[model samples]
Target chain A: MTSASPILIIGSMAFDDLELPTGSAHNVVGGSATYSAFAASVFAPVRVVAVVGDDFPEEMLGTMRGRGIDVDGVERASGKTFRWAGRYDTDLIHRTTLDTQLNVFASFNPKLPELYRDTPFVLLGNNHPALQLDVLEQTRAPLFVVADTMNFWISGEPQILASMLRRIDTLVVNDEEARQLSGIYNIRRAARDILTRGPRRVIIKRGEHGALLFDEDGIFAAPGFPLEDVIDPTGAGDSFAGGLLGYLSNQQQISALSLRRAMLHATATASFCVEAVGTQRIATITREDVAQRVDQIRSLYEFGASTM
Target chain B: MTSASPILIIGSMAFDDLELPTGSAHNVVGGSATYSAFAASVFAPVRVVAVVGDDFPEEMLGTMRGRGIDVDGVERASGKTFRWAGRYDTDLIHRTTLDTQLNVFASFNPKLPELYRDTPFVLLGNNHPALQLDVLEQTRAPLFVVADTMNFWISGEPQILASMLRRIDTLVVNDEEARQLSGIYNIRRAARDILTRGPRRVIIKRGEHGALLFDEDGIFAAPGFPLEDVIDPTGAGDSFAGGLLGYLSNQQQISALSLRRAMLHATATASFCVEAVGTQRIATITREDVAQRVDQIRSLYEFGASTM
Candidate 1:
């Protein structure tokens, strides 16, 4: 377990304005790579490959470096960083995208450092499928490769997404995106159809309902922790992916048992991610906090079998 | 377990026209009591108290008698039976109510047989909350009483529904209805708020995501079986209620362990109910079939703990 390799993560680094029912935060440090790298750094060494702008704060990078995350792959351009604005509905499930400015990320091309090329565990964060594929070509054969996508890529870049899907070991997408990708409303059938495209496993993230892992072995339904207050849900999914890959990178083999444990850890991390705007809660959570939440999750769903 | 009391079920007996993506069935046997009784009869003796019209088929009554269900409490009126027409969307989750002809059921009153009044277990099937309260008044103090309601009653008869809620042992409602009833979007919070109203337990059913049991002790999440083909989802909720109350009636005492098993059986029964229109699959399913599906559900969610 201690001999696991560092995890390579590539995606956008942005400043986001989020409006939630409870409150709102503007120009906060938020991005898929930032959230995933922070979450994964808790379990294993992480190398983040993303582009930011001159406008991006220095303290954010310092925070990542302080957490032992390698920032050598992060590139700083002359313009403003990626920016996004969104608002969550009263239910906190439906979110509206107010605006999205790609900025420096619009023409960004990830150049994996020589050191990151040998990283055994790679997480291709939510980005253009073409860009994800480009990163895939740069990295050597890794122990595992997991790719995340959304409805935009599934609909806009179907061919490139399909090509990228064929090369990844795992595909992570939310339930709605899964339905859109497979053209099947039933999640069980949708996951099965996606597996035919290539990924050995498909993880469908159902925010409040929890996550489901579908593979050849079988299906695993993980329970989502019930939260009394969720301020913002900006980076929960990315955090989930980070926790999962981080835990798996530490394992010698990814067995069903291991994947289940990873799912729980992922669930715990994502729970914290939504507790505040951006990654405030997840950024400060100790391993002990995660362990306690995992224990709570176990108790929430555990039921002893009765002799019939 | 053998000394368990019979279950008293009170609701409507209707003819339904169901249109799903796969196919459609017209004037089929349907109703909360009909579905619940058939599902409950497998576990315990069921006494159904409902109203139907002259057009109601004699064979349907014979079918109940054939399954060992007591129908002496069923009242015969002069007009046509209650009829409902609904169409399921492609997702099979959102359903459109095309027509609802209450007919005889509009002014019907449930006059329980003297024998049924003494039944220890009772299920107040989905109907007018006022009617459910009326039945509650007629019955003696039962060991357990479970009431099922829908959004229609929650919106139309909030005061009566609230009044009825205070007298029941458990409340079974789908996720959307739970939110509407509690005026809270979070299912966990909604269930918690419901417990304050009266029922000791609240079961929030999330169609594809499964069900969650919220009580004073804690929450227990049960996974829903994944079905590739769902012909019609008309009676799934009522069938779920039937399976749960039926199993509980057979237990000496309803413990959390027993409740979880009951949920599993309910889930399995509901799974079969949607396989075809109305109660087609549920009517023919044996206890062995339910047992097998319960086992499958266990395996679907079973995950071994890893030493992290």
Candidate 2:
């Protein structure tokens, strides 16, 4: 294995109040940055840059630090931390957002620390496009940049998102967000439209169906690992992005082969995320566990080539 | 190439009135046997056993005969043909059934001819459980038997469906039917529950999402061919089953590898079915066309084995 580079993650870190059919949990640690950091840390060092309130626990930061995640870039301000409350249906596929308290995250302005300015890999977690662009501007000639966005930012910050799209090398979004962003129902056409807008590569994450990677080379689909039960699905998409970039950071160079393999790793990590609430499963799992799951996913899609 | 064996298909032949998002078509020739016969005819000889009314067009049967699909088993009764009218949602994912006139189909009792009884491969199309069982009883020592079912029969004829399931080698149903029949939301679990019931193999079809095959060998997933537009999805499932059994009949022996490769052909054929209102595309396409689409579908899921 090559030496792994640290991935800079910029987004929010907060507490989630989840009402799942299996049960409910309050003050669960979650958020784009939090989930991404834990997932990425499994394969490489992670640098988190986000703001939390003084009410946030220092022990969580210590836990991350123990896992080789740098928390020096994390800003702790005066106020309650960002808290989101959501309720999931029995199917666990759809959820309704019951509340959102931005708290210190409302004024989140990600500032790259001096030591983090030269990080070669950056993961702009799902956030406002302007803020993502701000981090991109601060980076000094990064080797790769992957930005994740959602419907809220696509509609609210279209112009800025467009600008961010041009700057980022890869754009990741869920299936619904891809359609909403491109105004196209067909995912293939949507990815084609997004390619013209800016990003050279688009990864559309479909919850249980699996994920598709569209690049100049061609399309590669990774089958989602079949889980008997899902405890939570709060940060599956972010965890996928985290694992993708995390695995890519260890590669000698990013190529079509590398990207496709990275997607398999991403799929494996995301599968573990949904097995437990928040990042419980991802945080506790080892690299070997991920590799094993990767093999399972590969077998799921593997078949002999058609000779007819 | 191995010499192909003829496949005996039993189901209904009827007239369909479709209201699609793109347009509308009235008096369209369709039904389970019709679609399956056309799709399977791409690879092997297809013997169709179905019931139609005197109002059915004689030229339609002539068309099937031209394609190497035997229509001697098709019964022409003295009544109007079964007619169905449905309107699709704008997304084309859901539809509202406007009308259903059972007509002659209500009395469909499949009685395979003596010649068809010797056919080694049989495809039991979606219909009442009793009718499906009636066809199964008529078949001699068959090398393989594949059956398709729907929700109406599962809910209405549980005992009969259970009996039929034990007699078939393979059972094919869409994702919804799998869940409804097994009473499990998770598809993997649903398939597991189905495996205990009787059939050695269970194929869960997820329309645009592709299809999954589960058996004693484990599981194999075939990605759905990405289409820019789907004209109509009326007979895609039947076409899928038809192509699957068709390709299987041409194989020297049905093993894990053959079954997996057959799924690719099935996916390719089903992709073409949705390109037109009824079976237009599948009926017109040559074997080479289906092979080319199979190659494309294989690429959609092909990737390097993970070394990380």
Residue-wise C-alpha lDDT for candidate 1, range B1-308, written one tens digit per residue? 25556999998889999888988889999999999999998788889999999999989999998877899999999999999999989888998999999999998888888888889889999888989999999999998999999888999999999999999999999988989999998777888999999999999898877788988778887788777777788888899999998888877478888887788889988899988878778888888899898988876666755444
Off by over 4 Å in 2: A304-308, B304-308
Give me the TM-scores for chain A across all models, comma-separated.
0.97, 0.97
Candidate 1 wrongly placed segments (more than 4 Å): A1-4, A304-308, B1-4, B304-308
All candidates: DockQ: 0.58, 0.62
Evaluate candidate 2 and give its CAPRI docking class based on DockQ. medium
For model 1 chain A, the run of ten residues with the poorest summed lDDT: A299-308
Relative to the true structure, how large is the alpha-carbon lDDT of every model?
0.88, 0.90
A1-308, model 2: which lDDT tens digit per residue?
Answer: 23899899998899999999989999999999988988888889899999999989999999899888999999999999999999999878899999999999998888899989999999999888888888988999999999999889888989999999999899999889999999998889999999999999999999988799999988988887778878899999889999999999977479888999899999999899999988789788788999999999878766655443
TM-score of each: 0.96, 0.97
Cα lDDT of candidate 2 equals: 0.90
Pairs that clash in candidate 2 = none
lDDT by residue for model 1 (A1-308), tens: 24656999998899999888988889999999999998887788899999999999988899999877899899999899999999889888898999999999998988988989989899999999999999989999988999999888889999999999999999999989999999998888999999999999999999977899998888887778888777788899999999999888876568888888889899998899998888788788777888899988877656655443
